[model samples]
Target: MAATAATLALDVASCLSHRWSWLLFALPLLGVASIGLFRLLKLPLGVQPGSVVEDVRNDDRVPPALAPAALVGTFFTVLGGGSAGATATSLAMASSAASGLGRAFGLAPRGAKAHRLVHRGWTAACGMAAACSALYGAPLAGTLFALELVRFDGAVARRLPILLGASFVAWLVAMPLAGGYALPAAAAPDPSWQVAALCVLVGLACAAAGTVFGWALRALRRAFVRSPAHPALVVAAGGAVVSVLVFAFGWQRFEGSGLTLVYAAFDGTSEPFDFAVKALLTTVTLGFGFKGGEVMPSLCIGALLGASFAALLGVDPSFAAAMGSVAFFAAAARCPLAAVLLAAETFGWAVAPWAALAVFPAYMGSTDVGMFGRGLTGRLSRAKRTARDKRRREKER
Candidate 1:
């Protein structure tokens, strides 16, 4: 259902873009409309994709309204040409539905709070796995993504098989409806030390890019929070900026999730600054209270940046692009293992080893808190405080 909603929204947007080109001028109005819908539904503004997953991981009860609110919000945001992806929407919807089902089934019996919490976690994980698998068309990657995103705690560990089964079944059901998201196969690079070294450089570059992207998103959200203007005004202003960008860059190049640009990078036809443009636009669209996921934009950024790196270093653009797509997402999301599996599933296992090299460097070099995880800076500070306290106690003893 989430996939269908996304597909239908994109199809409508495409039709409008081609037939009613003048609608570009009314983007601000559309943005206002999206926010208005959310406001009418009494949902909070700037609800991010990761927040829902975070709630599930923390074993917080998922609100029944979250699924519909997210779907409606994402649909309108994309319809207005916001830089967002539907994968997050799918995850949100599925997880919320799972939570609702658990409640209906009385998964939490009296005096069994611990049992209820575990049940909630695993059911949400299963839903997430199914949604991701159906959307990406990679059941293994989808399953691993759910596990990694939620962290492989005891609760998740006990229910691993169930999650995997859910993902596979979802993929099987969605295959005919949405099809797998497959990229063109690139020739595997020869295993040479020089190529391996270059992969490290690519990873570092992408990690840096990921850091910047995360900072930009946080900065924008902070700015929005601090602004004195009404949210409607802020949203309208964001839409206006997006309109200008669309007019400056071809609409087709910046539309929807920028998957077209990803394909272009794979084909070695992306512009030099495609990544920069996407990063900026995505930052603006998402930061200004738009509802959508960052996963696709992250992949888009990595693919374009990798393609550019390949062009400069005299390497295979497709191969570099494939690596960048996975490495950058790993750095930004802080999920290297899942990313490696994603690389293997999408680009064939032949690319897995090189992808690992890129992924780890990107992961290690990443400084900013990832898009989905809790703030890394905060985590580091807490750790430092804990160590300091421990040392003081030892000295006193």
Candidate 2:
């Protein structure tokens, strides 16, 4: 009997030694830290400034002036050519979190408030990394992103100080390396009642558009993942499809990520063809498993669509595009605060009013899909309310 008991104990120990067996406690920290680091360093991952933005106002500077057309043709040959640090950077950060940090550091993964804080900090790190990398000049954006996107629980709010600390650290690291596309030091555009109304409209349109984008991409991805065709064949077919589209449409809009096109849209240099080709090309790239982020491509599509609508509405295209960008993200991800912070970070304070205006409707319109299963109740409201209600009902019972 003693021998059997000993044998059982030994078996339990052996089973617990497997790496994945520890995941119930380790996974959360890994998830958090990797995301944190990804947000910290992902900004400098694209085409250089002035080179990508087509500032028609400065058309004399051949490169910036011709960036629109040249980008279409030239971007394909380059490595990591687009302004796409957000998704890649964040993914890398998440990977880091998952890789070894949690285990190496013996961090807590799941449990009560204090334990959750440690994990939350790690997860929030991704948002910080993203903010630092994407906005660089604006650390607040990174911090808010952590809160808006990563927190998801009111209790995590207690860790705000820690998140802010990481964001500040990330910002300090980012500033020197941020190069030309650093956060513009200007204020956001003034909140015109006209702009606010326009933002509402843009938000609604983006909600519908974002839902379509999410569903379409999922369909395409499902088709690719399930197809009996070889992976290489699938990729080659995708590349060929993109090539054909580029050739037929002309490269002014449908290359990688369409950052060039997005920048062009901001500069008022994009044509309708640019929008169409980019939208089609992006869907194809994601479908083929190129390993990229969708936020920018989706933003590009929304901006173009918004710009087109703005022209009809007699509103400013840049303003409308800004709102559309965030609105689409909010709808797609159900991340309203992150979407708003992102708008402010990328543009300026002026963007906040419009972003806020757009976020609500977009969030309302968003379909129930997200990159990581982020839900609409958002991080802060979901858990606490449920927990409180449960306790209350239990007490009554």
Candidate 3:
């Protein structure tokens, strides 16, 4: 159902972008309005858990805004060349709906509030796993992802069964509805020291890119975030800037999730300029308070980088791209295990070692801050890190 919903939304956006090219002009207004309206309604925005779940006044009760906020990612991002991935969007929406399921299902109000809240969290976890599995078509990765996202809560062991059940059912349901490109896979290459060594280099390069992207993104967000301001104005201004960039570039390519470029990278049809441009556009989209997750954009960037550098690495373009995308994305999200599994599961079992070639180093190389604001924790911006380092240095002195 989640996959179907996203496909339908994407299809609609594709039609609109093609049929009424001028609707692109209205995206800035729409982007700004979406933020203002959702805030006015106290919706969660659902792009990040910090934006929703953390806002619940009562720690025990689910936030009233979770359900509505989940929808915001889909609606806000699909309307134009905007950033955010279906994976995060689906997870947010499903988790939220699950959180509210107790009230709808009337699952025994006889239980204590704490018990009910526990049930809701468990349910949300399951929904999150299922939604991601459906979107990514990798059940284990999806399940682990859900668990990893909420690992900080420390209830992982108790809720394991519930998450597994929910993810299994969701994955089964999604098999039919998910109708599009699957992650490409390959068999592990002949084991070679050279391959292992190259993997390290790949990881380092991708990590460097992730670090730059992270820092640049933080810098941009700081300009608007550090002030008392009307969000709509800020978002609208950002949207307008994005609109101008899109028009000037004459490529809606930077808009949306930017996933197609992954395939294009494998096929050698991609332009050298795509990675940087997409990164800039995505940073702008999110920096201005445009709502959505950063995974898709990150994946696109990884694909572009890997493919572009395949010749230099003396590897097959497809193979290099496969490693690059996995490593880069893993670094971007700071999830080496997830990245390895994702690469192995999506492309081929053969890609695991090579994927690791990139994944581990990428993780080690990238900063502690990730694309999703440290995976469910408060953001630690570059400035914050610098300031902290400075204070530590003074103490040492």
In terms of TM-score, the best-performing candidate is 1
> Whole-model Cα lDDT per candidate?
0.78, 0.50, 0.67
| Candidate order by decreasing TM-score | 1, 3, 2
lDDT digits (tens) for residues 1-397 of candidate 3: 6544765565567557657667677767778767766777775432354333332212244554644554554466557667555666565567666767755776425343455344445556667677767777777777776665554354443767767777777777878766423665444657777667667776787899988988787666766566467767787777788878888978776667776777788777787767888888888887777766577678888888877776665656677677778888777766667788778778877777688778888887788667555643233355588899999999999
- Go through the candidates in order and give the clash count of each: 0, 19, 9
Model 3 clash pairs are 82-256, 183-346, 184-347, 185-347, 185-348, 186-347, 186-348, 187-350, 188-350
User: Model 2 off-target regions past 4 Å?
Assistant: 1-86, 94-99, 109-136, 151-158, 179-193, 378-397
Angstrom error at residue 144, model 3: 1.0
Tens digit per residue, CA lDDT, model 2, 164-255: 76566655654555431322122355657776777788788877777776677667777866778754466456655655554554452344
Q: When superposed on Cα atoms, how far off is each prediction in RMSD? A: 2.6, 17.3, 5.3
> How many pairs of residues collide in model 1?
0
**Cα lDDT for residue 375, model 2?**
60
Q: Where in model 1 is the C-alpha error above 4 Å?
A: 108-119, 375-397
Q: On TM-score, who's better, 1 or 3?
A: 1
Judged by lDDT, which candidate is best?
A: 1
Error of 2 at 62 (Å): 44
